[model samples]
Target: MTDKQRTDRGTREYRMGELAERAGITVRTLRFYRERGLIPPPRREGRIAWYDDHHLARLRTIAALLERGHTLSGIADLASAFDSGRDVGEVLGLGEPSEETPVRLTPEALSDYFEGETTAENLSAALDLGYLATDGDELVHISRRLLDVSSALVKEGVPLSAVLAAGREVRGHAEALASLFVELLRPHAAEGDLQRLRPLAKSVVDAELSLALDRRLRGS
Candidate 1:
């Protein structure tokens, strides 16, 4: 805070016991955390040390995060993520977080395309696969890439069922690919290996996907 703001706010601070009560934690836990260097001690006035709401709020956040299975060190890493501006989701293993775009579709075209044959389950699965979306009671192909590929496959006499089967198989392959990397790294990767692993894994995955796409297109 600005010095003026701090002064105007009277440096509103709380003692260890008071802050821990406010944060729904035990004073002992807070003291232990301080001792472990997971949390820094408050500033002192003679013999008394005091904490502010910033510290209380941060502690509460840390507690919530720990309940979510994050280590104290992991919580510190997350707190630092704001300043670093790196892939927070990558660090959290929550995938690349992104905004969802609502795709539009029209019902009449969807009815014509599906011949009024699409089940609700099929429609939901199609949406999950980026194949279709609700466009006013019509399932609409939201992705031109998927539409084009499926069109070519249909022309080549491959049924939609076979295409869906292949999709499930590919998903299994992705799981296997992930397992392979985990096994490879489990024995020797030190802490903070994700930075090195991320680019390596991305490159390998992208290359594999590219070659797989080409192989599929060429009927291999």
Candidate 2:
């Protein structure tokens, strides 16, 4: 079998030189990145080191981030954030989101979504808020709606930092609102009535928020 076809734990493994060739970097550059901890250490068997597809994906992500004007130091920080972020199963817990669609994004795709705003701080904040989770080499955003709204706000000239701050505030209010609705309904609700009546609570909040925005605009 070819060196490329070698299997490590049921996944394809490549020698350091072959990995560098596949990732379009020289062996020297790969070593530099490894030295800086940009990529995880490879699996070792005897005297030979075996890099996997995950390393290749990380290298490509690094290249993409560099193309988007990210400095190596900044990329290293971002990589740290990404690696340490929560996983999807942990974020979702016992139940998946009932109505919101989760979005799986490659690192480059996430950068595209926020342009130059995809900083380590913002990524860390999103992970802290449970809005983002890691799934292998990709990121899983908890809600497609929230993702779209955030991207739109950034495109509309709202700084991502401000957007994330606003989200934090909104999260508190949302949680309170949810608790209020649950308390109000729990006494009278049947076994599954709370789940069934969730949309009604959502509608009320949506309408109230729209009116609140209108009033704020008029007052301004």
How many clashes in candidate 1? 0
Return the TM-score for candidate 1, rounded to 2 decimals. Answer: 0.34
Tens digit of lDDT per residue, candidate 1, span 1-220? 2211232466667777777888888989888777765555687767767777667656765665566555666545434432223222222235321322233343323323443223334344555554453322223454455556655665577766566567667768877887888777767897578446756776899998899899999996
Error of 1 at 17 (Å): 1.0
**RMSD of every prediction:** 18.8, 1.4
- What clash pairs does model 1 have? none
Which is the leading candidate under lDDT? 2
Candidate 2 residue-wise lDDT, 1-220, digit = tens: 3567656367789999999999999999999999988898998879888889999999999999999999999898899999999999999998789999999999889999999999999999999999999999999999999999999999999999899999999999999999999999999989688899999999999999999999999999
**Weakest lDDT window of 10 consecutive positions for candidate 2:** 1-10
RMSD of candidate 2 to the truth, in angstroms, is 1.4
lDDT of 1: 0.55
TM-score of each: 0.34, 0.95
Q: Which number leads on TM-score?
A: 2
* TM-score, predicted candidate 2 vs. hidden true structure: 0.95
Which pairs of residues collide in candidate 2? none
